[model samples]
Target: MKLEKSIIGMVHVQALPGTPNNKHSIEEICEIAVQEAKTYEEAGLDAIMIENMHDVPYLKGAVGPEITASMAVVARAIREVVNLPLGIQILAGANKEALAVAKAANFQFIRAEGFVFGHVADEGYIDSCAGELLRYRKVIGAEDVKIFTDIKKKHSSHALTADVDIDETAKAAEFFLSDGLIVTGASTGKAVYLHELKSLKDKVQIPVLIGSGITAENLEEYWNYASGFIVGSHFKENGFWKNPISKDRLKVFMEKVKQLKK
Candidate 1:
């Protein structure tokens, strides 16, 4: 899907089974995810992305079959009700699993981590996955699923490639055949620097996305530079991730987005 100036609202699926924090049953989680997706569509978001963000202490690299299975179920349920272009993201560098889920759920794209360059994430060292991930995507016939990879991703230390600036990182991802690129702050819900985004816009040909800290008040600053915005925390109750999605907050934010579009 073309993501030009798009806003992809996040449907943070509730913690699923087999995680340390799994609280809700699979049925309950799917119901909540569908509701949030419906609200995003109703609020005029351009697309939706289902993520296993609530599965804290996330598994590194690959996840168990149950986690993959549960995500497929949740994503498919969300797909049935929400007509917008949908996407999926399995946490902590589970790119292959995410692609599989996306293929099965008819998702249009995926937010991939650690696609190029290694990093020390909370989960541990994440090796570059461009070669392996692309091969897997082709094998599974999921070439239609766009892979938007993160560069100098949040919540991780880029000490391994500290000498390489964001410009080079974007170029490397592009060289590795990324469909798009995602830029973010130091961590979740933090604001990304404006100058970095401006630099990337000049350096890369592929779409560049702002992946965190977007809200009604500050979106205008990044509006012209970003191809898309992947928003989550700001639309939640009290701007917290664990809380349910707040329709009132979504209405206010989308109103501002509409105004900017004009």
Candidate 2:
């Protein structure tokens, strides 16, 4: 499907502290997520994607039931208040669980890492999951929920997939039936290369979204090639991902994007 030039707000929900990571609880995390979702909606973002970014020291495969259940509950609550399109993303390529949550919450899409290419991420080796993930979606009857795969994904080592260039990798994803393609930088919250964005846009027929490091200053330059943007870090305090989402920052960013769209 064709994607319009729009701004997609990233809501990095805080994970419950003390389970293995920090000091927040599931309830606290959910509360923050709900509030952030409302803020993003009120800020007039085109869409919102919920992610367990704080669930650092991420698990390789399935995160236990508590994490999934907690995220689902929070995601469901966000869906209730936000009328914009909602998407879910779990860390470390848990595509099946993400699809299930999107299905249960009636979310529109999922941001999947390692969807079409094999890469070694911060956690460990992440194998391609297009075949199994699609089949899981089909079996669960959630085909309407789009899969946005990341090409040359951030925070991962793609040297193993070095034989395939960015353009060919994007083409492969399209051939494998990815609903959309995400182009990110080397790590989380990093900015993607405009040249890489152009190369992928020139190669793929599907929508191309900028997945990291979007800011008010660079929004216009990327608008020419990006169908949409997944902005997070710059929207946070001091432009750091670990910080809270800054309402003032969001307001300014959205204003610039609105002007560009006009």
Candidate 3:
């Protein structure tokens, strides 16, 4: 919850066991995750977020115990290797399950989608889980696990809330007690509209993080408004999240962020 405009690198764990893209064994997956996390820490990034992004064709929520169990194992491995603040996020709005993984793995935060407003995602309709998720967090004694929720999340249809503007939507999340808010573009790896970010920054009191598409070219442009950046694609080879982490790409982006901080 205390993140300041710091660089947060993404550790996109390969397809977990039981998913379609599962080629690596669980041991192999964890080893890769730990290595990537260490690379981010060594590269001077402030924090690392571990996500099951490769688990494509995701279920809407409660994606079986295997998903949560696999995530906890990977998270625990990374937790042991790096001192950077660690975060976990379950695909397709499984916020409570994500909190469970965070608690089990001793993570500091979770990037949650569908914390407010309902949307038709590729998997199905995702309803607001703020009430259920917060109560569950309290029950597990994981109040320290901050929730950074996505507003107008990428890869979803918002036509259901066409009458509501983003400012109003953000206020709703704030009212619902979100730890912080994430603003993203239309899909993964897409850049957010600067005007939308600026508008939200002026109106929202809590932290406003850019959840996608922050490259060296636009870091300065977004630096003025975003409290933090949850980056995955820009750090990967050729700006693709599924590719291996590119030290060369990360170096250039971090250098730009360093200059912007000054």
Candidate 4:
């Protein structure tokens, strides 16, 4: 599979639940999302993904209609502002909802949490959705929109399926027609294991992305092994998500990635 060398930045919109400072209205959230997308684009990142990461303690299946509709509006606004390849990810394993939003916003892809394997997560059981998700995508005529599946997902327990290794699970996703494979750390904002990244890259013919915990210091280490990265935390001021995206931090990170390319 062909892939881009540059890193893929994530704009984790401040749409989480129960935060006093969080935006209460959908209009407010979408406005912030648009600004964040433009910032990521200006930073020279290859692509941008908008996720409801702030919506912590996420629900198991489908979220409320308001959440989905709100997310669509935010995603659409971001798409309107940036020409970069846009992706949408609903919290937990809301694959169908995310796909719907992606289709509505004309997004290029989505980051699916539990696409091809069953596992126990903090919220509860996250059953594999590759079968249903692909069918839904077909029904909506969004076959061109890529499905980037996560293997050995973070912040969740895959111990129920521990008997199956990462390579086997990744192969299963590929068999199910996943457009790409994402290998993440054990939790959000954590770094991935280089060993696991190498193993997955060696096994798959499709694009493989590191989904978290990338920093300027480690970009060189993983750049050669994976096709791309999805970064968020390190780009923020003092490495905090709530802090604004730092222009200097982004400049430094991009410089490192460029040097590695040479």
Candidate 1 error regions (>4 Å): none
- Residue pairs with colliding backbones in model 2 are 17-23, 17-24, 18-22
Q: Which candidate comes out best when scored by lDDT?
A: 1
lDDT of 3: 0.90
Candidate 4 residues 1-262, lDDT tens each? 1357747888877764343446567767777778878888987888899888788768896787867887888888898889988888898789899999999989989999788878888889999899999999999999879999998998888888889999999999999999999998987789999888888877888889899899999888888888878888999999877678898999999989878878
Candidate 4 structure, TM-score to reference: 0.95
Model 3, span 174-240: residue lDDT tens: 9999989999999989999988988997787999999988888988889989888988999989888
Worst 10 residues of 3 by lDDT: 1-10
Off by over 4 Å in 4: 16-22
lDDT digits (tens) for residues 1-262 of candidate 2 = 2379867888887864434565776777778888988888888888889998888789885777877787798899899888999998988788888999999999999999887879988889999999999999999999999999998888888899899999999999999999999999887778898888887777888999999888898888888898889888898898998888898898899889778878
Query: Going through the candidates in order, what is the number of backbone clashes in each?
Result: 0, 3, 0, 2
Estimated TM-score per prediction?
0.99, 0.96, 0.98, 0.95
Poorest 10 consecutive residues by lDDT, candidate 1: 240-249
lDDT (CA) for every model shown? 0.94, 0.86, 0.90, 0.85
Clashes of 2: 3
lDDT score at residue 11, model 1, on the 0-100 scale: 87
Q: After superposition, how far is residue 102 of candidate 1 from its true place, in Å?
A: 0.4
Total residue pair clashes for candidate 1: 0
Query: What is the overall TM-score of model 3 with all chains considered together?
Result: 0.98
Order candidates by TM-score, high to low: 1, 3, 2, 4
Clashes of 3: 0
